[model samples]
Target: MESTDLMKKINSFALRSFRDNADRDYIHARMAYRAQLYPQCFWSSLHALEKYAKCILILTRTERVRIKKNNFDDVGHEVLKSLKMLESSLNIILSQQTIDFLKRLENGARFRYLEVSWHSESAELTILDRAVWELRRYCNSGLYSYENSPEVKLLDNVKELLQDIENVTVENTHIAGGRLEAILKQPKSPARKELVWKNLYFSNSKRKTVWLESNFMAENSSLFLYPEIIDELTKYTRIPKEIVNAYKNG
Candidate 1:
């Protein structure tokens, strides 16, 4: 593949993996919050938003040199750095409240070691969840835009076609082999079958074919599914009824 195609594939794969990973982190964070594991909740929430920021940067094709210059390449957990880069590189403005929240969350020691009880109350948890939701919404919208672009749509269609062809080929090859094996097992031509089977065995012995299983990640892991907190939070926090209902049904 050409360099451009290679980059596209890399970015596309990163975007997808990061997006799903971010969602997984978010769900885990919520689970931690509901369980009152405050430190884990804070850490997981920050990591989730960090992945969201990285997804935006990757989709924008932000250069590694640029990220390195900003020192974002050095610290993967620096959500603020990613946010700043996203703002500067893409001319996108984020809320000051969100920025401040991220800055406070960036204190690695606090969340890592349980130095502070930042999310004790339902209101505090709601605030943190709102920030996470905002970041998730933004990155999701950006990814949606890229996915719906003409070039990406075309590439996705071609990939689906190729996968379909591969599946059909595998199925047909298995069917043909089964049919041949059944014919070879028939009792009427024992001598002939033995001769043919020996020849086939010798021919197969001369060449080795290794079948490797594809390790593509499953798209619908249970971890990514919406957790029970989506409904529980509504009872604790003053989240709007419509929003809560939508989330519950979503």
Candidate 2:
């Protein structure tokens, strides 16, 4: 019921969802490419890259800003926007060629729907390949940073403790002749409550909704993390600690 508990639940769900979506989009992109669905492949790859970029943003606690009034769609599908966010927030420099490719593939209107003249298949494939490679590198590096982070270790510790408790509870239930009611009635530990609370809190946060939205074409005006989570994420993020701290305190 406490705010901290609610935030823990939300963080868990958000992290899990981010991980799943990143992998799913990347796999879909690969599948589309292998099937010779060039247009679909281009668009899917862009989506995967965008999702991965957003994950980096969240991990580094980057705050999104609205540059234009009532232009949510512009912010959401703009690959350039994501790149710029990474650059400005985490100092992740993207090469100009990479920027150009992403800008071309920013929205699916020109490629996905066949709105533009068809290009040579080989040329398009080359472009797509390069984009995928660069984006994959960025994503993998971000994930590596996350994996080595202290916050991840803390979260893992919480998960292990929860698992241990569950294991003991199950054993007790078995010892008591599988009395389901007694096991179900056992008091939840503070750690358990905290984890559940975070999941629930984050589930309701805008960060989760924005990232999970299926309409990749739609623009999202803002992207941000819950401040409390941001505070903790800042501690172990690759972004400059001063910048993160300033964002948190500002």
Best by lDDT: 1
Write the residue-wise lDDT of candidate 2 on 111-141 in tens digits: 3423223332333443443444444333322
Q: Ten-residue segment with the worst summed lDDT in candidate 2?
A: 171-180
The TM-score, computed over Cα atoms with residue i paired to residue i, of candidate 1 is 0.49
lDDT string for model 1 (2-93, tens) is: 26566567666655677667756765665665555666766887887888788766666566787688666644787777767765644434
lDDT of 2 at 144: 25
Model 2's lDDT to the true fold? Answer: 0.43
Candidate 1 structure lDDT: 0.50
Residue 60 alpha-carbon offset, candidate 2, angstroms: 1.7
Off by over 4 Å in 1: 1-8, 70-73, 108-111, 114-122, 140-250
What lDDT does candidate 2 reach at residue 106? 71
TM-score of 2: 0.44
Candidates' C-alpha lDDT: 0.50, 0.43
